[model samples]
Target chain A: MEKGILETLVGVLARPTSTIRSICQQRPIGWAIIVYLVASLVSTIVWIETGFYDLEGMGLPDVGMPTIIVGSIIFNIVILVVFTALSHLAASLLGGKGGYGGLFSSFGFASLPGIFVAPLAVVGMLPMVGALLSGLGNFGVLIWSLALYILAVRENYLVSTGRAILILLLPTVVLLVLSGLLVGLLLLSV
Target chain B: MSRSKIIALIIGVVIVVSLIVLFFGQEIVPPHPRVAIITLTGPIQGSDGGLPFPDTAITPELVRGLLEQAEGDRSIKAVVLRIDSPGGMIAASQEIGDMIKEFEKPIVVSMGDQVTSGGYYISAHADMIIAQAGTITGSIGVIFTHLNVDGLLEKLGIEMETVTGGEHKDMFVTPLTPERRYLIQRITDAAHDQFIHTVAEGRDLPISEVRELATGELFIGRQALELGLVDRLGGRQVAINVAAELAGIQEWVVIELAPPVPSLFDLFLGGGSILREMAIARLLGDEITLLRTLLKTYSLPRY
Candidate 1:
């Protein structure tokens, strides 16, 4: 039997390998969307409370709080879709046999780590040790989320851990090489 | 449940509890006695539905809201009104000026780059006014501009026909007659007298002395100090110190009262209006924009 949403969420952190495999087999797109929505809502709330979206201090027109909240939620959802598509494409090029729905579901579940942002933001509000603790906590959460993402790719694509990491890094490597070549050509022309 | 699952569940519960606390933990604690700073920048006008721009225009409603906030808060001992404007509507300025005079707490005005005409009209009523050495101020007069575009319309081969209930109803659209000019001049003179009286009363100067300086001539902060138009020659820090001194507070914090956050509906509607204005301005070219501004400016009596 397929596990429920709550069980699957806890399972992702507790037993990632099996949970991710179950997620691939189930392909619960609706639940995946709900997960992304919750993560985005949490992110928006933290940003608003912490005044992270206020641009007036930088001498720019303030895109008001409502705009920031709505814009961030939409942007985050778009990023999830775009990131999944790119990762799936890269995995396909690397002789992987994962389907799109399985990869998307796993990637969506990976966003569970972002829920810790709320607690970390509260720590960030402390007077002296707040900044350091918040920074380290956020870094840890980011690494945790990245690990989940790698595992998602590995389990869904039926690939080794090394191949999954390589697939994820493929886009970045190509962009860097393209940028380097462009700079060299500009210098030669000059 | 397994050990790892139990740990994850505990962590999840802790996160939810923290989120609830963060959202609902706002309890107003009595703060240290502080001097609240309310900044008034840009042209003074009526409220524009509370749009969040970089440099928000000064409005009587905005000032009143901030003043009410300061008055209600027991911790706020005094207020520093930091003003940066080239003046605006006469009625709006008078409304703010009246509020300043009636405020129970000590209030100080800190002049910025150019606080002239209606700007000075409002600042004159503060308990004390401080300005930088080169701050432009003291344009204590009223002005009314009448634009006659009939000749321009004729040149463009466009004649305007008007139906009016009164003779002067169409006076603005046509060339000003001698009688209309005298009538307009009298109104301006009355407003000018009112400006002079306000400055004299607030500055504790004689009517004749204030009248002599009310020639619509601008004065720098040093000249204003020498002429008794301003009490002190200094910056915002000096104004804050004077406010603190007047309030008789030794140890006090400084609080800046920012505008209220805009709602979602306000964001969508106000943002649409701003975009519409920008689009019109871009499509109409610079000259049309300037003409529209001039028409808006001259449509009413101003200080």
Candidate 2:
């Protein structure tokens, strides 16, 4: 009983379970990352082609719907396939179970917390209170990331803290670099 | 702590600070001359459906009241127009802009989280305008929005009632007549010209320079400063300090404008979102001034 109590205490001390459901329950994180990325790409294409971003600028290209759709699909497909493969490799290394679904689930879950950015940025602009809240808001994101790490620990597929940290860092750098390269290529091609 | 209790603690601290400032903080400083804090909130004009969303506009009446207060009061060393709006209708925007120009006193505009088109219009001529570095501003442009309510009306088989010498007299109602589009364009151009003109004059930028910003784009405070839209980049406390310094007041009081009434959330759930609470009370019974909000929103596509 005492041992059970101690283990329970440790679990609680480890921080509350993410309550985000089982890691693989929703869209597999790996595929979800691809989906999220693809959606983002599509949204950007729509924004540009629809002249959404150009609303502020006096003039912008008269890019048609066909170009926008084709561009978005092509970009997203490339992104999805690439990230899917990488996530698979990561999963294999971590001794993760299953194929596409498991890898996708982990990838998807890792980035879920970023959705809070929209609301956080919006709310952060308030005056005296806003100044105070936005200062605190960045911490919530950090906590969310830590919570994901905990979730990973909770599942049998645990990493050495250093390996886990590296896993997080490498993928983020990969995405950023990819996005930057794509943006540059798009701009240059245009 | 449980989330509720943690939230409660935060509330308690904010309230304590606010109260202490309200009641006793002024005694320590030397007598700083008084700065007028004209209460400006809610829809700008008469409250008969005058906004895209009352729950989200800085009303005409509020602007009018502020102007009136400034004109009437003499003890007011200077006026600090604290604006917290995400922009609103062209009419309201213009009216408020006119009021600011008419005001005789030295005024300083202090933008909160969001002081966009209409809000910026009201404070453009202040001796200075201060905004937080992350504060969303600019959106120095104009637009007209029309929702396709014709389908809903058709579904309900709601027939229109009209008696007009001109066919397009009710130019704004939707299923927007082709003639109405022309009229709207004229209106948009006029408002746009005025917006560009005011920003140009206020920021001392060339008309062409201002036109660059007139793309109806939104900006962070830093960007706004770079664009010459805002005079300073800081939040309310900085605005307050600047106002005090400008007014030559050594020991003065700083009071926030109270909401006209409690927000729906405040009425029921209570706590959280002082902004939303203020928004709910002031904006209820207002129309959705969608042109500015839509324009501003579309302008900020992140890619």
Candidate 3:
């Protein structure tokens, strides 16, 4: 039986491997999009509350709050799409047979950990231990989310844990190498 | 509901509550009496986003926004304008000065390393001016430069033609005729007089006394204190104390009205300019860096 959205969300955290396998089989793209949207909106709200877009105090040009909110959400959505696409390509290159829809759905659900950023940001606003705790909490959330993503990739693609990690790292490594080469060429020309 | 559903509901509630609290917490809580510190650094210009660098100069719009924030906040009982500038455009300085003069609450100015010309124009209207002993200030004059590049152009064998609807339309590029010279002199003198009068009015000194001190001469903080240009010889802390004292608050929190914490976007945008500036600073030392900045910011008809 197909799981409910709430059950699947919880399962992604509670039993990521099994839950992600179910998600891949189910391909709940609409629910996945909704989850990603909520995560992005929460992240943007936390950022605003933490005073991220207040440029006036720094003597910089004031970028409108609305602009930041909309821009950041759109930017995050684009990143998710691109990341999922790149990871799908990487999985394909590694002889995985996962459909793009399944990977995208699982990847979107992986963003559920980002909602914790709101609470962590509040903890960060504390007087003394705020920053440290917030930083550690955010780091923890990132790690947890990465683990979920790895599980999602592995289950969807029928890959080993090591191969899943490699698939995830492939996009970043390629991007960095390309950037470095471009910089090197520019420097040489200069 | 199942156990997972209950857990999810709890998590959902926690996130909703956090968002609501973060958004509305400040309004819900009673704020403490605070003294807001608004910094006026670098040359005071009309607006930000000047070439080479954008954030180096102080702008009237920035000052107005900060002042308005302090004015609107009931918790903020007083404001301290921490000014560190060599001064820039005349109109920008005057606009900021008018804001200071019109502010309902007590305002104090704390002078930094260099507060001269247009800087002093804005500070002159503050309820009190505090400066360190070594602070360089009091360049109380207006300057309008007419660059007659006709000579340079002639030397370069590049003759230029000009069409004028008015007699003084081409006065800037051409050599200043006696009539044009007199008109320009009158304008500068009027601006200088206005500066003297503002200083006298704000400091409660006689016009003659202020005039004597407003000879376009730079004075150290001690000399300014003696000359009645500055009220006291102290630093930012003293200014803050004075502001709090003036506001009749024995115990108060000092809130710096600063920019919001920069986001990743801001860092990405500002990183190039910051790195370029650092490189320049390293290559040419601090003084040259400052000179370069001043050159970039410099405009005509300034105090």
Candidate 4:
């Protein structure tokens, strides 16, 4: 039977290990995408409305509302796909067995914690300690998301916690090295 | 209940508690007395998106909108007009000045380093004008410049042909004709007359007296105070105090109003990519300032 979205969301935070295991097995890519997109949409709207991104002093150009919304969604989708691809590759390299559907669903569900923090973005607009609360709330959301990501890795591939962490760190390490090399090359050419 | 369910229930409870503490907590807070500060930085130009460059300068529409917001808000006891500009076009200055004059709430003008020409024109009608001791202000006059770049084109060995609907259509080309110059002078004089007349009425000085002092001369805050052009010589805090006194309020909270909702261009092209980083900065107030400094230090200069 398909799990209730709320029940699954609650499960993800409460019992992440089993929640991710069931999500991988069920391969509910559609539901995962919906949850991720809805959460992202709410957070992005709050981000714009609250003037968190409205620092004119930074001289960043503001695009249209539609563009921001559409561009952000497109970017989120792209990031999701890219992260899935990287994770799949890492899993295969590490000799862990997991299908693309399972990996995608598990990763998608991993983003649920981001939704809980969406309201915090709006709440953080309050005066006084609003900014600090917002920071802490965002930090909490990130930690939750990271934990979910690790659980997704471990359960989907049946890997140990240490191996799951290694798999998760692979993409970031690769990106940093590649960027550093590109920068070094440009500097050398100059 | 199983361990998983128990853990789930605990997590749910924590999330609920956080929501109450962080979200609803703001609503439970009491409102305080606030003095809204509307900043008018850069030149007071006409409008946006007309020229090759973007119109990042303060415009009449922006000023008018801010004045209306300040006027409508009861929480806002008084408004502070923080102006730092060398001035802009004539029509924009007049529109903004009229709006400020029409504002029912008490307003105090806080002049920055450069408040001259149109800047002075707008603030002259405010309830109180405060400037720093060394602030440049009171560039009381009007001017119109017509570029005669025909010689430069000739030096570059470039000849331009033109078609015109009327005789004076090509009048603005290099080497301004005598009739065109006379017409331009008349236009400048008319604008000058309007400026002095408004100043005289606003300052309660005679038209002749204003005209005598309005010779396109720049003055420091001390000189402006002596000449009765500006009411006081001080900075932003003093302006706030005066505004509080004028509004008959003993205690007040000073809050700088956010600039008008950023243009869409700002949303997408400008600050969009840095949304994540900016969110982090917004959460950590001081980090935003630090991030801005870091961005400025490393980012390539724009022309």
Task: Write model 1 residue lDDT over B1-303, tens digit each, in one string.
Answer: 766567767887877876775565344323456899989888877655225462367788778878987897676899999999998888899999999999999999999999999999999989999999999998888888788765655655666678999878875656778988887888889999999999999999999999999999999999999999888989889989999999999877777987655543344335424444565568876666666667766887789
lDDT of 2 by residue, A1-190 (tens): 2223223222222332532224434334444455345434434543442224342122234466666567666775575456656645664566655455543444444444443343343343343464368547757865865666445433423445555455445556878999999757743542
Instruction: Give one digit per residue, the lDDT tens place, for model 2 in B1-303.
Output: 555455435543553453343233335322335566654543333332322233344656656655664565444567778777766666667667777777776677877777777777767877788888888887777766565555555655567786778767656554667777787777778778888888778667899988877887888989888777888887667777787788777766554433234334433334323444345545642323333333343321110
> Which candidate comes out best when scored by TM-score?
3
In model 3, the Cα lDDT at residue B256 comes to: 87
Query: Which run of 10 residues does model 1 chain B get worst, by summed lDDT?
Result: B264-273
Q: After superposition, how far is residue B180 of candidate 4 from its true place, in Å?
A: 4.0
Cα shift from native, residue A42, model 4 (Å): 4.6
Which predicted model would earn the best lDDT? 3
- Ten contiguous residues minimizing lDDT sum, candidate 2 chain B: B294-303
Q: Give one digit per residue, the lDDT tens place, for model 4 in A94-162.
A: 988988888888888888777566557545645567668988988998998888888888888899999
lDDT at B132, model 2:
84
Give stretches of model 2 more than 4 Å off: A1-190, B1-32, B38-57, B161-163, B177-179, B256-303
- Name model 4 segments beyond 4 Å from true: A1-8, A15-18, A25-38, A41-45, A48-82, A90-96, A118-127, A158-190, B1-38, B47-56, B61-79, B102-106, B160-167, B174-179, B243-303
Score each candidate by Cα lDDT: 0.81, 0.56, 0.83, 0.75
CAPRI level of candidate 1: incorrect
A120 Cα displacement, candidate 2 (Å): 47
Q: Is candidate 3 or candidate 4 better by DockQ?
A: 3
Q: State the lDDT at A86 in candidate 3.
A: 92
Per-residue accuracy of model 3 over B1-303 as CA lDDT, tens digit each: 998899899999989988887787667754567899988788887765433344467877778778988998777999999999998888889999999999999999999999999999999989999999999999999888765445545655667788999877865556778998898898889989999998899889999989998889999999999988899999989999999999999888787886333443434334434444465678877765654555444425789
